[model samples]
Each structure stands twice: as C-alpha cells, then as structure tokens.
Target: MPSKRKLVAASAISLAIVAGVAAIYQTFGGESVTSSVAAAAPPAAEVDVAAVISQSITDYQTYSGRIEAINYVQIRPLVSGTIVAVHFRDGATVNKGDLLFTIDPRPYQAEVDRAAAQLASAEARNGYASTDWARAQRLLTDNAIAKRDYDEAQNADREALSAVKAARAALETARINLGYTSVTAPVSGRVSRAELTVGNVVSIGANAPVMTTLVSMSPIYASFDVDEQTYLRFLSHDTKTTVPVRIGLANETGFSRQGVIDSVDNRLDTSSGTIRVRARFDNADGVLVPGLYARVRVGGGAPHQAVLVSDAAIQTDQEKKFVLLVDKENKVQYREVKLGEQHEGLRAISDGLQPGDRIVVNGMQRVRPNDAVKPNLVQMSGDAATTKGSS
Candidate 1:
C-alpha cells in the first residue's frame, strides 16, 4: 500500500480526469441538438398573387365641377305699370313668346286710342291744306291771286304735312307702349315665382327689379377646372378633335352622362395653374339642375398599351408606394411603382412594373422581403378562380 500523501494525490488526479470527460461530452451533445434545430424551418406563408394585366387604356383625370344652365334669363318688365294678371304658375315651364304677365292693358289701350284720335284730326287738317295749295297753284298760273298770297298758301301746306307726320310717329310710339303691357317669355325655360305679384307696380330701366327668373331645361353646361399640365398634355394637342367628357351627379357612383368639351378658357390662370373648361351635356330628361355639384372626367388622347393591377396589391411604405412581388425562387421581393389613372376597378401602373409580373394581391402583411411564399395565382380582377403554386 502507498503512503497517505501519495493516495491523496492519486485520488485528486482521477477526479479531475472524470470532470474533463463530462464537460467535453456536454459541449458536443449541446452542439448536436442545436444543429438539428437549425436544419428545420417553418412552412412558406400562403398568399394570393396575380399577374399584371396588359391592355390598351385611355387615361382619364377626374375633377370636381358644377352644373350650370346654358341659358339663364331674368325676367323684368319693359314698361312701368300695375300688374293686372299673372299668366304662369310659380315655377312653371314657359315657352318662347308665352305670355307671363299682363300689366294693365286698359291704360295702354286708352293712350293708343287718344293717339289715334289726334292722328285723325291732323290728317283732316293736312287734307284741307293740300286742297288750298292746289287752288293757290291754279290761281298763280291764271294770275288771279298775288304772288305773296300763293307763297303763304304753299307754306301752310308744308307745315300741315309736317304736323301729320309728327302725329303718325306719336301713334306708333303709343302702339309700342301698348304691346309692352304683355310680358312674354324670351326663352323657353323653367320660371321662378313672380317677384312682383298682381296689383304690384313695376318700373322699367336697368334698376328695375326682376319679375322672376328663368333657366333653360335642356342641353346644360358642366364647368370645371383642369390643371395646366393636364390641359397641355391632353387638350392642347388636338385643336379640332372633340375632347370627350363625362359627368356625374353628387349621388351618382360613376359618370353616367356623356358630354363634349364646349369651351375652354382663352388663357390659363397663372395663380392656380389651371384652365377653366366647360362641357355641354344633354339634359333632355330634365334631371340636371343648375348649381348642382358635378363630377367631371376628362379623357386623354388615344389609347396606349399599359400595365394594370388591382388596388389591393399596392402597398404604401411610408412616403413611397410599392408592391410585394414574388420571384421564381419562391421568395417575395419589393417593387416600387409609379401610378397613373384608375380605370374601372384597376389601377394603371405608369412605371416600374411590367406585364405578366406576379405580385402579391392578398396576404401581403404576412410576408416580408425574401420570404418564401406559397402563391395562389388569381386574376387581377379579383375573381374566384385560382391555381396553387410555390413562389
């Protein structure tokens, strides 16, 4: 047997060797477990994808507008008189030349009769003077009257003729005033309530109060403003080609009314960088009212090939717009895009995208860039039919 000190040293060495072996085993075993876990990965995320559509599209820009009447007339009296009768009901539709009000024809008729009597008296005097002049001419030829007396007779005839002409002119004036007693519609339109009712006195002149208002019922106007860039790009190119326009009411969803650009402002407004444009629309149904809100859409030039996609595919990344695209390696990629006009339910991709490019339309939030995805191919129109594929 060894001594006590030797035994103690031998035991210590044996224990240290066992501890070293245990540490090595634990380290290797832990590494093996970690390696096994790293080899496995979660399943690819499922997402709806669609191929960008290619089609010829005409770009259209929309703007807020207002409906206006083609013809807006304010009814006013031409002569001053007491209103004797109102021919139209309040808010009645009247045709051109339709009688609207009668302003006491009795007074005008009396003046006309007085003028006629005065004209008749003047004509009688003129006849007598003419006969006297004829007699004076005969006396002068026969030398039966003095020269001065014949001259006086001739002068009297001329004066009487002048008086007759003056009387005839007065009669014509009286007849015109009489005709003014009846206030007629100058245009065919819907009229407002009479401002001056029966027994109300109306005055003539520019300062005269409007008796009522009238607005045309058909072929109305829709006015809107177009930005300078849009006007230069679309409207300025073709001076003669009719620019197509469409309008919708406040409650309408789409532009239901078709119209043509009627007139454009001569100069663009520098302050707003826009040009005022007016469109003519047929209001035969009498549904369009003046001063009503309207939505105006102006179509650009000829249709051109364009790439389109559904709005759902577009993602907003802070200030920039992008879409999640799936690559052939079953990984998601980011694509920045410039947007143009919207047609139907599809948005036109102005730049940064091509036709047939697969983009994630649904389940975009579940995936990130370079993420593997199980793409379910669907139409860009959001149809139900789909095909499963790994992307």
Candidate 2:
C-alpha cells in the first residue's frame, strides 16, 4: 500500500492535470473561445473619411516666362548740337510730341538769316535782269540792238531765277535744322534718365547716342516657350483666336491677371523642340513692367468631370502610390491610383477610384489594411473643421 505522502502527491498531480485541460478548453474549445477573443480585441480606429470629389475641372499648363513691353523705343537726338536745356525730369511720364530737350539753335538760326539775305539779294538781281531782258526784247523788235546783248540778258535772267530757287531751298533746310534743336518725345510712356546732360554736345546719324528710353504701359506682353507637344495641342485648339491665359508675378501664388494668346511662332525650333508664344494683358494700373519674371498658365481643353481627392491622403509604397479606402463594412483596403494635375490643394485621380468611394483622409497611419475603422464621413469641400460626419 502507498504512504499518506504519496497519496497527497498523486492527488495534487491529478488536480493540476484537470486544471490545465480546463484552461485549454476555455481558450480554444468553442463559442466561449470566440466570445473571449472578440471581447479582447480593441475597437476600430477612428478616422476622418471623405468621399471622392467629382466636378467639372479645367486643366491648365503652367510655364515660367517674362513680361515685355508692347512697344519699346530708344530716344535719340535727331540733329547734332549742344543740349542747352532739359525739358523733362528723369523718369517722368511723357506724352507723344512733348518737348524733351532743347539743343543750341544759334548756329541754325544764323544759317537761316544768311539764306534769307541771299534770297533777297537774288530777287533784286532777278528784277534787274528781267527789266534788262524787256528792254532788249523791245530793241530787238525795233532791229536797233545786237542779238548778242539780248541773248546775254535772257541768260542773266535764267541765272538769277536759279539762284533764287537755291537760296529758298537752303533757307528751308536751315529751318528744319532749327526745328530739330527742340527734341520731342516720339512715344507716350515713362522715359528713362537723360543720357546727355545740359551743355553736352550730341551728334546725329548712325553713331548718335540714345537720349532716353520709353515703353508703352497700358497693354503689356508676356512671352514664353512651349514644347512641341504643347505647341501641337495649342494648334489643335486654335489658341490664337480666343485661348485664355493667366499670369502672376514671381512672388505670387495663383495667377491673378487674365490675358489672351496673341501670337505663336511660325515654325517649331528644331534645336530645342519648342515654339515661342506670346500673351497680351491689360495693365491699366501700370503695375506690370518689362523684363519682370512671370508665371503663366495656358488653359487647355474643355471642361470635363474629374475625380479629386485630398493630396494629403495619398501614401507611397516603393514606386506605387495608393490610398486607404473604407468599404461598406468599415474595413480598410489599399487602392492604387493614377494621378493628374493638382488643383485647389487636391489631386485629380485619373484611375483606380470612383466618385462614390470613401477614402481615409486623416489618421491613415493608425490603420492597417483589412482593419476595421470608425469613420467620420466628411465633405471634401469647404472648411475641413466645419465638416460634419454623415455616419
């Protein structure tokens, strides 16, 4: 027979074996196991979810360009002389035909006086010759004077008339030179500083120095280059007639000024595979200036419906871009998407999404694929904070 200590040890061993079996059954047996495990699992993650947005979106192609003046002119002296007076202040707005400078007119005035005196002297001589010719004609008719004297009188009268015509031409030239002494603005625009100051002599002809520069202010031009593909697209649309364009300064974000396509290059540049394009915008406020850096957007295509989603919701995996989608059962799934141009802080999804699909816009990092989520459905439009969940 066994001792009392052996009996106690055997009893303890049997009880431990029974307890272990009971614990296993509770953990993996049947409905109790399922209920216990389900109770232990944590609740679904709360997330901000938004349906894909659908709208008629217009696409635009952006390019960096420069602003140019519609009309630019370099003011130069017409006649050579010392600048006796400056009629315009530096950087002042001037009108067409406004006096800008005055050259020394004394020399030209003296020439005019001299030509006038010569004309008067020639006229007096012509009168004397005419009278002599008349006397010779009468003497010739009477057959009392030599034909040589009559011929000399006729020749003298013709010479006097020729001298008078030459003097008159000289006087007209002198007057024109005198007028050139008063330099005038050739265009209406803001003028630059005077290149030649008062008392400085300026010369005319091809070597003449530019006195100032002027550029038209109201309508300005913006020039840019477009690639072969873009050029073809523009040609298909016939952009020159009514293609819309927008412009913004370098420091600005969105294009604030509107313009129209004015011209396109005749041929594509073979070296760069691009074509030159120009746009014209009204600058009535005179804020746009030449050589300014510009950001331009050329409109493309007609309006079409596009699916957009918040860009922040997109996640990248290696080379593939994806988004977290919430199904009807509130289960999260990974969806791959193709993207297009971004507008208003959202990205256009070209494929792999529908307008009615729900995407996890926020708290995506906290959820995993196939995980359940407590979604707060929100409208993608308007203020993000003000949006309320429909679910």
Q: How large an RMSD does model 2 have?
A: 5.6
Q: Candidate 2 — which pairs collide?
A: none
Kindly report which residue stretches of model 1 are placed more than 4 angstroms away from their true locations once superposed.
Answer: 1-50, 134-153, 235-241, 326-333, 362-379, 382-391
TM-score of each: 0.75, 0.76
Give the candidate number with the greatest lDDT. 1
Worst 10 residues of 2 by lDDT: 382-391
lDDT of 2 by residue, 237-341 (tens): 554557778898988766889988888878888998888989999998888889999988887768899999887888999999999999999999999999888
Per-prediction RMSD in angstroms?
7.2, 5.6
